[model samples]
Target: MALLWSRISSILPPNEEQFPLQFSDKVESSVVEMLKRSRRQLYCDTTSTSRMLNAQIVVDISWERLNTGTWRDVDKEWRRVYAYGCLFKVAALCRENPSEDEVLQAVRTCDMGLLMGAAIMDNILQVLVRILQSELRKTAKDEDESEHVEIKRAKIVSPHVPSIKEDLAIPRMKCPSLESFNTNHLIPLKPVILEGIVDHWPALNKHPWSIDYLRSVAGCRTVPVEVGSRYTDVDWSQTLLTVNQFIDRYILNKDQTSQDGGKPLGYLAQHQLFDQVPELKEDIRIPDYCCLCEGDEDDITVNAWFGPAGTVSPLHQDPQQNFLAQVVGSKYIRLYSPEDTDKLYPHQSQLLHNTSQVEVENPDVERFPEFAKAPYLECVLQPGDVLFIPVKHWHYVRSLEVSFSVSFWWS
Candidate 1:
């Protein structure tokens, strides 16, 4: 207990004033009290069981309030309460024999706090999460080496090829210069497939984004996943799951069937995952082409798209320029110009106005007669390829196999 206390103390601020500027005086005082109570319990010669039980009771009340209120309406102070509750839980567990699951719970709790809580408080929780992750990694590595065990790798699925006309294909360029790209594509609002630009990324060569490697690095981290078929479907919904659980049920399970004997697709789409697990961020680099935009580098938004072969992103348009980089497997994509907006039937509702009501693969020619005459371009994106999509260009994407892609969006 003393050793654990020493390690945690080193990470904590020396005084309340050193806490994040966003923290109120009341929250600071509450944190100081909790830390004092924990320190006494760890250092005293005799254990005070009643003090620990009282702390648990306080945490329970906070948890109930947090679960009851509407998420956006809930007071921010409740996040602080829940975050400290998790810290106290970790302190209690460390006082006795603790299992690996107990430690993982601590890491997950901190991650949740960061996800839902105020970003200003991230400095404290992010460091705590790193410490817990390091301990888990070290323990797992030691156990593996001691047993001399070998982990079996999963087989890669083959990509599905689609037939298309060569005349309507998107033009391809091999690492065009910044000036040339601006003159040919950016100014004209054209789409093009770029090669040789992302071949040097570590995710492509040095530390290839294989299934096993992703599982090893981020299996335990919690992430939100989209469930059901495509987002346009009536049954579509979202749920949270650990990275390992998602891989096991969605990626590894060949049948891709749900427990209720129905087929449901799971997609980890449009998530800023690099912010959650910084280690994975080191494997990829931002393209220098983003400099053309008039903003700081931090203004760019990066998102990860990972799922099985049949996953589909319905035909929709984005307001910003996009560079979709494929790190593994392949995808078949189709694009329509914004000028043909009336040709494709876009939904009337504000929520889905950007998404077309017509399903490109199985369109109703009678209901949407103009759609048949809409001119478009198509391409099959391969690994290490980056496709530049102009702003407001209606694009549709379908993964050809078990795939992972990262997208960069900027003005």
Candidate 2:
């Protein structure tokens, strides 16, 4: 317990500057006082639980206020509240004789703070969480290697799907030179699949992204997952689940129905999972092609797409160029030129203006007559393939099997 406390305390910012500089002194002082009060309560034998619940009430009020504001307009005080709550949970767990469940609860608290709080004040929480993650991983590894028990993995049966025709396939290149790629694809704003480029990525070789490996590293971390067949569905919603829970429920037991007795699909789509789990991020590298963009290299956005077979990303056009790298499994992708946007029938609402209402695989020809006339290039992206999608190119993606893909978006 003393060693753990020392490690956690080593990561904390100076007492004089605990919060971000943008926050008012009032906010900093208030949060500091709250932490001091919580620490005192935690050390007290009679009032620890009651005081912790009261502190939680205060944090909940700030959380509700945080949700009421727009994304860019969120109040900074709410971040302080979340950070304080995480610190309180850490203090509670550092107390003598904490249970495994209590340690996990502390980890979850820190994760939630990272998910919702400002990054500027998250150093302490991040370090604390990583230390706990290492401990959890070691425990899991020990359990797996224990001689008293046997560990077995369930047999995975992949569903069969028809092969796509290659007559109108996207052009494929094998590690073309920068000048060649720029002249042939970038300048012409054409899509192409580049091979031999990502072949050396650790994700494809040294640190292959196998199910068991992913579970061992990130199984305990919580992540946001989309629940439904597709985002365009009326029933679509998002929920947070631990990586292991998601794997067990969605990847391993795809045939099982949801708790509500309905077959609900789970897709971990368009998430900055790398930011949450740095170990997974180390498996892949940003392609050199991204340097051709006009914006600063740091402006590039990386997103992860992982889900079971049959997951779909409805036809949509992004505002920036994208390099969709296939690390595991395969996907059937279709791309339409921006000139055919009207034929794709983008949704009228501003919220969905970038998304086409028409389903690429099963379109209603009568209602969307122009879609049938829309000429598009298609391809089957195999493992280690990097597909370059030009800006504003309408694209649709469907996983052919359980898959994990990384996309880098840059101007």
Local distance difference test scores for all models: 0.77, 0.78
Residues 1-411 of candidate 1: C-alpha lDDT, one tens digit per residue: 135445665776565456433345545566556645654554444453644564565466556767886887667776666666555555565445456787677677666666665443445667766777776776774334421221233344455599878988989999999999999999899999999999989899998987778877788888889986589999999888888788877876644554245678899985557888887888988998898987878989999999878888989999999999999889999999999999989999999999999989899999999998999999999998999999999999998887899999999
How well does candidate 1 match the true structure in TM-score terms?
0.85
- Off by more than 4 A, model 2: 1-3, 13-22, 25-32, 39-55, 141-161, 258-262
Model 2: per-residue lDDT, tens digit, 1-411?
335655665665535334333445535565556655665564446454666675675467557757885867877766766666766666566555455666677777778877887654546677777887876655554434431221123324454654666778899999999999999999999999999898878888997887777877788888889988789989999999888788878876644864346677898875558877888888888898888989876799999999877888999999999999998888989999999998999999999999999989899999999999999999888899999999999999988778899999998
Worst 10 residues of 2 by lDDT: 146-155
The number of residue pairs in model 1 that clash at the backbone is 0
TM-score of each: 0.85, 0.88
Top TM-score model: 2
